[model samples]
Target: MLLISTQNITVKLKYYFNNNGQHYFQRSIPRALQRFYGDKKIVRHKLPSIHSQMLLEMNRLAHHYDQHFKALKSGQGGTPSQIQEQAVALLASHGVLPGAANTPARVPEGMYEYPHLDYIEDYLRDKKQAGTMTKVDELAQLLLSKPMPILLSQATDVYFENHEHGTSEKFKKNTLKRWKNIYDVTGGDIALADVTREMARRYIKHRLTTVKTTTVERELKTIRAVINSVIKEKSLNLSNKFERLTIPKKGKDSVARKPFSQDEYRKLIAGCVSKADEIRVLILICCLTGVRPSEAAGLRREDVYLDDEYPHFDVVEYGGRTLKTKNSVRKVPLIPAAAKVLAQYLETHTDSVVFPRYCDGNEVLGDNVSGATNRYIASLGISKTLYSARHTVKTLLDQAGTPEYLAESIGGWGKPSISRGYGDGHSLARKYAALQKALTTVLVNESE
Candidate 1:
């Protein structure tokens, strides 16, 4: 991997090797990054048998391989800008710009350029008979047609309006935030066509430097989705900038959101009892019921049914209230642990909303609760956050071997069941039973 410098170009000879009179090009992907390549620790490409040709081709492959390795390490996706730059720089080595010629050598730019009627007929017959005419037509339109000057901002505005019409405010907000990442990178004036593959590559590259690959992946996918919708709506003849791109997967050792351990759970519960705070009530309710933080914090007096048979809480979208998703609207059976504290907490305070400190009528500010309670947990020297309570429930249920559909139903997760267009879903008794079993496995053992 040593650098051999020359007048203007430096070529690494380590990548060029000959085996049994057969010349081959090879480069190591590096020890730390070998997992990303799977079994392919060393990359090998066959080179020309001739010495002069091998050296030139090797240099090009070296740059290509080096960039690829860098991308793998940094989670940067390849983009159009880099390719074009290479074309401008290594145009002499390529003989023609990359993708300019169909063949290894230059081909006629077009059949129409030399349109003799008989020649046209023969070419048409040959292309059609070979079943390659459609590909040619697509490639021709892709390369030759001048895309209309539609701004990226304009397309995004129309996409949210038309395509994702009924999406929630949170959805719209998140989508806009992700879209703004690219808009900020390239500016609002960049056209859909102008938002080239290189722009996406550079965007992922830049984002990866700061954020995780997973976040950038979602951002890129959102951009791709918007562009796709715009293309269909406007009938624009252009490729999606985010299409056919490969963003690296998260490394195996990446940190993930984990449930609180038994020790952590005891610490949190102790903190709740000692502090006697409303945010702790929100955390405990979420832990016991598997309701989202927003759902618990957003509960109205009408939503709580302390006298009910199962003593549950309803998550209806009445008034101007909103849940994360439609499935988030359900009734969760109140666990005894949550019920004991919450029942006492809600007795004297006659505010319509349960956690008024974190909520404003129907407009529930769960994030405020999350921030305050996360600080609370951190104060106790516990590493877990308030949201970990919800994750803890899921993990507990999983350990208790709760059925997938039952778990989904209890957590108000995902789509409606495929059974006869859905009835009232799992009854309160069944949902409570499954949840109680999970909590019993974790909480009952811990508390004892």
Candidate 2:
């Protein structure tokens, strides 16, 4: 029964605990505007109970109702068509296909009727009694015209059909997995129209209980892409509910991927050479050449060119791993130290892959390499991940006064504003010189 005290708003807040003891906010429309809102007057949404979040929801609703009331007052709110549209939109947004709303139970005993008509009807009835529904909204207009309804299950297939080129199988599978997760939460293979903003928010909330905020954020992003793809192909008027979401920051949300300090870099590299294991070779190559760990792990026997005047390795898409960007498919000049390490390793290894133990013919075992290297760094008392080596390379290159574009090329980072259609590219000798100078900061006595 407490009142919210934002400026110009004396909002009466009604809250109750859910089955899980979660709190939410309830609101009623101004009495005069109920008819314009399809005779609905009350609204409730699951809002966070944190004070700052509650205030944020307060501000958001204030602006929302301001626009809502203004629209109705100006004669721009519900009409017969707009009213039906709102019902269809809202029902779809809540995971109910509007076309199926009018389906009568036991229609002629076999007219291919939807079996759950009673449940849907009762759900509508409960909504009406709660004063959140208007006069019965007709869905015949949609059902008759668009007989072939789009469903969430069909969305990823449509999305990937047009967009899967140059992407890895792993990327496609992960995308499908994320969409399926969304579909499962919304009651399975539901109409695309049934996907709603409320459902998306709740999904994020639910997922945060199990995974990191960034992982949930990525899931939402992939879901959004699928929704947008469906909307484009079907020419549907569906709203994408997955955009511009707020994920409240919590501890352990994101570990800053920091570059290794010079002392740490020296110590880590020395440790790598001492072990001379597959992961250690990959780590040494990555630290010395500014390539990513995956890039090094996926390198093939043919990709490394140690006999050339300027020893370098190519980062082409290989072992079922696709290059992240077009620029990622370029070559990297190895420093003399990195070249020496690769040559020594190759003399004893006979596989077609440089990091043979970390790859199958299909793809590189990225997780295995990353976990092993990071754990190794920790064993030596360094707190950086394997990817930190890439960051360290960038830092050292800048310290060595390498040109920004050269640094970008070495790191395989793309710059959309610039074109790379010029002759060949930066010379290997030049790249070698830049990288050599950069490593000078990280130079230390090799482990005997």
Candidate 3:
């Protein structure tokens, strides 16, 4: 078969042939045609495409002709078949299949590439929606997968929207400051996976023995929160490290908790001078009502109900800075003596506050009444922090045959444990009133 084309003085032609059982090609046909016409432009334009197709056809024909030649030579008993067999035998001896050798080697496509972070972020987001886990748990899980900076950023975002966020601005500031401090100490650059158990153990050691245990524990809890959140939100794999991290048990003498004894209370009240009368009255009100200093400070004249079946003060105003917990909000019943003290204190002032001077009926007393109260307690040769009043209430409830659960409830202790017997509900005044009543009962019995 032959193909030819010409334009002006150029000519292009393809010649194909079969000879016996073989295919042959002659290259001189295109040169012969170009000489016959001399049109080089047409020859140049079609040369590349024509040459490529002819080469492919020639290669295919050579392959077919070689197969036929091999068969014929094999029957003729030549060395060609023997050489071919020997070649195949060598390949097979080397554990290579001759049939497969020509089938073309297949190269498996490279594996799918993936980003390491996408797995971690997805796990954290999934964990966040599951409500059962604590925020600390979620955070710990997140931190375990993500880097510290990412975890820290997430924690900061969550902290601003938490129950603690709405508390006193000081509380928020202090918490943020603590986080920054931890970040500085930890280098703030490592991934959660890189933070090994050994590092955690060392950090815990530093917190318990050198630094304040509470401070370290608080920061630890925050970090734990980050991990837990990640696991909760993203389904990230993580171990619960907080389970192994033990916070120190507070020593009895360390926390500055002292409940006033009967004699100490009497001496404290007696030591109030003319100028310190308001503080004295405040102490008395605290002792009798068993209200916290902050709760007491926020008390208003109108908040007291003298006409109810039981005269009591409604602790509606939390510390001007905080509402604290739900237990802090309740009506605290006052005994007749405490009620009388409150009435007398209110008579001296015509403002909203039951004890107006502390706030000028505007601001509430914060958690720092210790300075004034401590001075007054010291003047009487008695030494005690005003918080001792709260403990005093717990001790009094125990001594007066009040049921533990009732006492705990009155003190706002949801569940009274064997260790920390009473709750934080005004433990001072309740205990003081109970002690005074017991003393009076003892004196009456002795007189009889």
Candidate 4:
């Protein structure tokens, strides 16, 4: 072992030999000795290059010299080589260099370079377009890597065509935020193809147990949709990535809930009357017309055809925004009971909206009505949702012997299997006539 330090001499070194690579110094080596016996000086004498093996040896020698000088300064009696070896062991233990105590890093057997990102990018891009998901990591990576305007263009497409207005904006923003979270978790540096099914599976697990199943499903669906859109646009040449991405089957695990019954419905409407009369009327509208709460909230006073031979209301204006579905803009014949509520509700309210404002003075958006309706349902001792009112109307129609096709039409449902054309005035009139005939015993004649 060698002990070197700097002193008056330009270059100086004091060496002591020991059987083992242990060393101690009897006196303090001056600073001049360190210059002569520096790391470069040692390398010059031992090896020409500071190769990996040489670096390890140099580190050992440096540590040993330091220890020897320290021990001698403290009056410890030991050979230079003995002290050096002790320091070498300590340095190795602390992972200063490759040694017996240090585990060698394993070289990856996989590919040296990242594979093609095009297939994955294209797949995720298509899915985002088809309404599969938003803020998808897979889709985002494609944009970031290629510097394409696909993300912005895709969002614009959805905004203009699919998601628009108030609640849709909320939905889009929320769904995109979830996609961002996935990117953050995945480090956002991986290619799409490398994003294996296992990666998606882990993401799903995190979403389901850590956050919410709804959130997971929304984000996953958005991502899948973006990939689908990319495929449709011919941006991706590979087969569906969704085919490879294994999302947990969520259908069986989701709980099915029942709608409110007639008596329960009455109780809920009554409870919400005091809390929010507007909400009460909206719920009743959903109950009578089989419209969704969002649809009912979107109703306008002008949409009510009070002068019709048989007075009814059209569901035209939606959420002070847009309609639920193209078919949802149909007219529902108002039973005398529903008409009575409408007349009474219109007496004081003068806004264009039918069920306009929430109790909190907020405009009736989908979310606003949902909370009010759910709370109203809960207050009535019914463990049902506000959406249950739509079901209740459907049940009532079924009990009244209305055919399923007519029920779907009257409810303004957009079932693709059904006729997509606007209904003839005569057909609606005939149905209402039949309904009037069926309820002749119970319904009072307004024309009389």
- Model number with the top TM-score: 2
lDDT of 1 by residue, 98-146 (tens): 2333333233775443231233245446767887764323332233223
> Whole-model lDDT, candidate 4?
0.53
Query: What TM-score fits each model?
Result: 0.57, 0.60, 0.49, 0.52
lDDT of 3 by residue, 178-287 (tens): 65654444566443444566666666666666566666777777666655655555455666454457665634225657778777765554443223357777786676
Cα TM-score of candidate 2: 0.60
- Residue 389 accuracy (lDDT) in model 3: 75
Q: Give every collision pair in model 1.
A: 79-198, 80-197, 80-198, 81-198
Stretches off by above 4 angstroms in model 2 are: 1-154, 157-168, 180-189, 204-217, 231-239, 243-255, 416-426, 446-448
Ranking by lDDT: 2, 1, 4, 3
Scored by CA lDDT, what does every candidate get?
A: 0.68, 0.70, 0.52, 0.53
Residue 375 of model 4 has an lDDT of 83
Q: In model 1, which regions exceed 4 Å deviation? A: 1-150, 163-172, 184-189, 232-235, 250-254, 316-327, 348-351, 361-366, 413-426, 441-448
Range of the 10 consecutive residues with the lowest summed lDDT in candidate 4: 36-45
Residues 1-448, model 4: lDDT tens digits: 3333356534233333222434322223444333222212221113213235544555556666576445535533233323333333222222232132223333467643322333334544666787674332332343333332333224324433533342455455545665565554454534343445556667777677665465566677776665465555645454444444444675546665566655675565555444446767777667656677776776677778776778887766433355657777676787665677677878877776676564212234567778877786666677888776676666666677866667677776645233533456566675565444433332233343
Q: What is the total number of backbone clashes in candidate 2?
A: 3
Q: lDDT: which candidate is best?
A: 2
